[model samples]
Target chain A: MTDFKNLDISTAKECLLKKEFSSLELTEFFIDRIKKSNLNCFITNTFENAIEMAKESDKKISRNREIRDLEGIPIGMKDLFCTKGVRTTAGSKILENFVPFYESTVSNNLISDGAVILGKTNMDEFAMGSANTTSFFGNVINPLKSSEENTKDLVPGGSSGGSASSVAANLCMAATGSDTGGSIRQPASFCGLVGLKPTYGRCSRFGMIAFASSLDQAGPITKTVKDAALMLQSMSSYDEKDSTSSRKPIPQYLDFLNFDIRGKKIGLPTEYKVEGLNSDIVKVWDDTINLFKKNGAEIVNISLPHTSFALPTYYIIAPAEASANLARYDGVKYGFRENSDDLEDMYELTRAKGFGDEVKRRLMIGTYVLSAGYYDAYYLKALKVRQLISDDFKSAFEKCDVILTPTTPNVAFPIGEKQNDPIEMYLNDVLTVPASLAGLPAISVTAGKNSNNLPIGMQVIGRPFDEISILAAGKLIEEYRSFL
Target chain B: MSIDNKTVRKVSKLAKIRINEQEEKKLIEELNNILGWVDELKKVDTEKIEPMLSVFNESMVMRRDEVFSETSDELVLKNAPESKSGFFVVPKVVE
Candidate 1:
């Protein structure tokens, strides 16, 4: 029996170095698991390609060659990333056969470090939905072990649901996930793992399929916080190819893993203590606070009064940007084009056949908000509210090193539950959207399991370029909890 | 906060997506709910706040307007479903 529960990168690295197991053996372990489970976690598996890469890694290790960092390690790339010569579907039929000639900067960084590609995980089409049900392929179920027999079970929160599910189920060591709103953190919260969304511009967006360009940033989803740190350290680098990539110096994340957080001040946003917060969620938050207090950390209550408007503002600004970015796929560019009689017919028919229902809804909302007369009323108003929210964080950071809140208002709901109600689906992101709108660094760390055994996460949010502080604070929480 | 059927139809057309009457009704309900939720934002006083269009603090850096410094092979055109000789093909507009 191959057991790979919550494996860390350093453990796998030690195994490779000691010759206890080969890269091929490790790859086979995951590939076989994928074959047996048939969990809708992945959209495409490059098994033959993965094996070839593994063999090459083995040859290097045998030659006493200085193995590249992350050598022989396999990672699942989200389908939103553009992989050269591999199908780069963004969980939509529109780009089903679209093969990117160029590799995304994040993937390129992974390849340069000798990380082997395992497969492209599934997601909500264009990273649009909070739940995985909007996927063109099918819903990706939560991989949590359940005692109930007849219950359909919970959703593996999305739009990066596939990434979280695969890592939680040990289908892959670590996976890449894009967080436009709550894509990475929500899934991580639902599936019981650590997920990080770095400050905007910390990671390059060169070849990532754009959702909301201003807000979309890619980061790591993994079991251990240390592995997530290592992965983010590798993936975050200054690239001239991406204009938005930060020119700031990269810090050694692993070096700070053992640093103590004694006397570090943490804040709890008063606005987050709202009316409908699940009692279990509030209990987790309170428990997390006690743990932090016990670790010699100072806790304060800060006000981010702009929290209420964040969800509405995010919905407006994100879709408005998506409408413009997605206009490139007009049936004439590189994507699936349907048969039509005239030029107009070609565009209309192709788009009508290509996008799913949720995508269309967003596009319409986007167009309406950004249109001539409504721009001032909707788009501009949302932008103003967005600024107030960012300012709210800036003010809070002045008084505290980090802010704490619940990752989501409640636990994961069952599949086919929120499909009929789009508003409820959007509301799942309420607690998460504020951090995203401000482009702050936030992480979701598994606090504990609830009465129903579902995982709940406590979010740690920090100022821009202060990701190290957030990680340090999260480590303090994890240490207090002591290896769950 | 009420999004009428006519408004939903117009927005769908503007968005370049084809929708049936059933979808239009569904969209109206959904949009109305969204608008009702968003109306809460009006209560907040954003009187003095400047709108943040982009997160990057940098504003409008100028670039050199140099012409045709170099060009790569137009390999992107090859992936298109329909293309002519070295150019994208579309139905004749001035026939």
Candidate 2:
């Protein structure tokens, strides 16, 4: 029997095909585990639907029919993705009772491929936070034990925190996470999992709740690089619904595994060594470079000079876009409604009460930046700086095939550590945002654990539509992720 | 760039959200803390770089010259907080 504790997708597929276990049996195991879980990882549970779907898949296996890519795999969908007839909260009270009448393209794709929908996982309210603390459903507790003594409840890094926690805890085979900045990779790092954020337009943004449309893209968080490849193969497709989606055909992602490093150029940027990075993380970062060099990769010292400005520039642009996107959530259309006799008062009351503190803070920041007289100095200036940040990657890619860095400056901290200070919370994404601004494909691989046995992740960033290169590098790093 | 209560109020008004006085006082400090980021962003020279709004650099997607939604108003209004006679019920807009 395969171990239920770490049931990765690759093994699950093999186990099902070999008749070692039925999909119904596997789905029941996950459902039972989720029922006993205390992690607060899911916002809504859908066991009945999952069981029904699993039964249908069993028939196909019994008849020896050609199986689909994600056939019968029970995975968690981050609440940000709209599921038809299922509640999608985007982790906010505003959407507490809102159920989508239609499915998101990615969720539609996942279902079309015969994947069972487990339930919606919790996330940051409107995907605005670095920690899961901002979730209206409450914080998701990291399953990994904090190496530090007296740290009882460590936070799963987020807005993909719940998705990461579920996968890491083995409550599900794998899960989906939407990365606006470091949402997917950070939480994956914190939980000792593999997470990938495909190039900005690789996955369609149609059904995913918009945080910052330009920056948001969904990807798979899993136990192995191969699992992420299998999930991405199903999630990614060109759609007319999302204009930014690329027409570039997705290569069979698994084909890129065992990516040869014999002649690959790995770029190491000096700027990622920012102030206040955890020394343990730096050690892991250095070790990753050495591992690459030993594998016959030519290492190049490159510079992404505009890297420091990426966080602030992201702060400006993302909030500006968020404020605009979230405007549709006023009392009338759907979701929660605050009763007010006056029309204007109803909009204000519903929004004020429905949104959390962090969401309001971002909306305020967004409104302030885009208001009259501040447009050129803040909003437009941010756009120009964004271009410079994007250009830095263009030039860096000209010299190298991939770039490597630490996913987070530190391992997962106990929840409530940075909750009060928004700037500190914002600083968590400093390393990951530059790649987002450039629309490059980046993946985080669990390299090793720190003194507290908390996980540390190494990031591999690839050029535009070049997910294969990073997946290849990630697979290599996964093999022998030596750390001090 | 430390924001005052007046500007915070104005911005909140623009965003159409309400805030209490205590929340207002805390927002001032929080917004000021974030100003440091913008201050750093100002140091960079991006005078010649063109502003980028979209990343794919693709032209606008020509919408299919066909009707998208036809006879689906009932389904669209399924989640509305209040609706009547095939239209969303809203409070009086004009005095």
Candidate 3:
């Protein structure tokens, strides 16, 4: 068997250009693996489409044409991204047969860069749960298993669990993931992959199935830090279609990896070392910083005073936005519809059957929080706390160039471990949510493995539009054996 | 604030999703636990901080008022589960 496991974008591009192997060969290698994969990481497989795409890519390569950024690469498209004429479910039964006429801006960019789409990866329905368990399709189990712990089946952390698993398990070259609240980073951490959630407004959310409009941003889940930089360079853009997307120039994120990290100040937010955090993660995090210090980087202690409030604030704000976004799925214009004589009955029954439990729970919470009388106490107050949390990141940035913390509180646990309790499941986002609430760029760099053999990740957060510095810092961790 | 059965029923109606007795029972316990956990937000004294209405707080972009799309009705009604001519045919709003 060829070592396609470590075949990253940079290497694959070289081999293609050097005629070591054709894009068709590489695409077939992955398509074969995906067919054999029992991870349940994909909702809609596009193998036939992929074969056509790979053929088209070979023409471009043989003509010695101006090679595009992601020329001939086979990548996973998270089901959240709408690929025109392809089944885009967003991991919900409602949109099971939903074939979009238009493509999402981010996915369109990747295709334009000459990438072949292998499949639409599964996710938590409407990107709601921290575990992949909530998908209407089925639970996406983590490819990683710890025999020492004797766990039967572990969950790939979500809502980009499929993307993470597909990439980490080498089912695809890399994948695109959308992060509303650590969807990209958390899953990547669990699967020992590098996931980057670009600063909000970095990528337009024009056709991404919206979970939370304000916080949802598109990014990459890849096998390596450099691969993440390459994918993001193709992903980020400004569009008039998305009002929140930044008009700021999309920097060559690939150039970020070349920058030196010596003498850069990395902030360690004390609040992240909270109660009941995994001892294994804490050890890896401390060792990662010490490695940085040895490499001539300065470590600074910073405080995100409102860090404690981020999760509560996220649960409130995200659900409130989701309630409004999901209102469009009423069985009328598109999606699964339950036909009833009464119009309102149709709406009620369609939604009752269309959405899974996690989604409904969020919708109800959103309805309650934004309902009459409760608005001030729940939704309005959450907004105020959101501002405070944003300010905390701003102040911390002032003290240091970037922030460093553990990507998740703990490593991957069994699939059913936290599913019964919503609060426990939501706790998985605690360390990652603060950065999301503030709309900053954060990457989960996979550090060394634990005693139980699960991967640990260290996150490096940067200033607004400062993806370069954070990528530079993340590259250092990638160099250290701690991350290898 | 903790939600009870009455509130769940009201909110479920507002959300246009039906909640049967079994689901209602599970929702009450789950939602109460979640909301109870979320009550930790009250600990923060948000005194005079303005509610954040936007991320990055950038001013909205203004575009010239012109029809940029000439999308056909066929395209618009392409995905409709039920359609008559160019219009999406939902359950009748008025008898």
Candidate 4:
């Protein structure tokens, strides 16, 4: 049996095609890994369901299959994406028993492409927290060790922590992740993998549990950049299901994987050189720049002067949107509906008990900001600042093809470190929130390991529908660093 | 400025989240800290600047305003804490 731990999508495809392994065997291997690891990576494993899907894939493969792009690949899905019949809790008690009747577009697309659903992975409650600790199920442990002998446990960053952790641990080959602000990239960075947050509307959002709808775009978290690209190719398509899905023609992301970046103008935003940035992070970022230079990519200093407002602006806008979107779950819809003597008590009791502390905090902040008295003062003001932030990125893109920054200010902190400080937790997305506001594509690829051997990632951001150039630049950094 | 206890209770009611006396005391302190930091936005010269509502600048798209749309899915609505045949069952706002 091939070591499922070491297999990437390319090798798996080759092995399956050569009859070295059946898709059933591959699916079983990862399913077995999930069973043994007990890493809190999965909240729900459709083992029987996956085995049945694998059997069908085996039949197609044996029939000299009309090779689906992601044919026979097993992918772990973040629980936030709704899967019909299977429980999708969004890692919140409010959705604990909720099984969606319809499949999310991303999940449906994966099913159509012959990707086996390995399981539903864990996440922060309603995809709210940066640290995985907010999960109702439990925190997912970082797969990488502090050292071979010392397994000093750290949090696999979240709210897509389970997706990243499972991929890093080889629980599944590649997984689907949603990035609202820095969800995918932060977790991927922590777990040492490639996480892509596509240009807003690049992937259909239909049936994906809402969390800041305008900002949430589903993308793949994978072991290799090529695997991520291939997954994106299969996952991204214009869907009538999602009204906001971009009508822009899909580009062959993998076709440009080997493209030359000889004359590429990479923009480095000076505003990211703010105070409190870890010196070690800066070192890795500087090294990544040097590697780009060695590969003939020119680097240019760019300014996104309004970047300082991104965090506050995001807090206001995302919560404002989330507050509105999440209102659907007000004890009057599917999921946990508490029974009380009176109707008012039922509405008050259900939500109060269903949502966790962080979700409640966000809801309160959202409601407070969007209330009639506060809308103009809080939400509107933040929206204007958001525009300024987007404008800053747009103007910078005019100067360069892609902008680069540290994906997270520091490497993943210990699990409980930031749990109590909401502001500190919110600040974790400082380097990432700006891109989301602009509806641009951004990714975090592992640049290098820190002193503790935890991975540090640097982000490459591109203009709308310019995912190719971002991936190209990412691959360049990956290839260039492989030599060093 | 420190948020008063009564204001904290009022905001809590506005937010639809219940806070006990002890929790309210804690929330009051936390809200003050957050408000102090958020006060920085007031420093910006947004005097003549227009406030942004949404990202896309689309004006009202005309459609058939008289068209009837389903208020709620029966199965979904039935899952609520309290629901009538085709509507959400909520407390009577007025007699």
Docking class of 1: medium
lDDT of 2 by residue, A265-369 (tens): 999999999998999898888888888888899999999999989999999999999999999999898989998889889999999999999999999999989
Which is the better candidate, 1 or 2, if ranked by DockQ? Answer: 2
Question: Which is superior by lDDT, 1 or 2?
Answer: 2
What residue pairs clash in candidate 2, if any at all? A147-A452
Report candidate 1's fraction of native contacts: 0.61
DockQ (model 1, Cα):
0.62
Docking class of 3: high
**DockQ values, each candidate:** 0.62, 0.78, 0.85, 0.36
**Per-residue lDDT of candidate 3, residues A255-353 (tens digit):** 885787788898999999987799988888888989889989899999998998999999999999999999999999899998999999999999999
Which runs of model 3 end up more than 4 angstroms from their true locations? Answer: A1-3, A482-484
What's every prediction's RMSD, in angstroms?
2.0, 1.3, 1.3, 2.8
Which residue window of length 10 is worst by lDDT in model 4 chain A? A475-484
Q: Quote the lDDT for B47 in model 4.
A: 68
* Backbone clashes in model 1, listed as residue pairs: none
Q: Which stretches of candidate 1 lie over 4 Å from their true place?
A: A145-149, A482-484, B58-74
User: What are the lDDT figures for the candidates, one per model?
Assistant: 0.85, 0.90, 0.91, 0.83
- Models sorted by lDDT, best on top: 3, 2, 1, 4
Residue A419 CA error for candidate 4 (Å)? 2.1
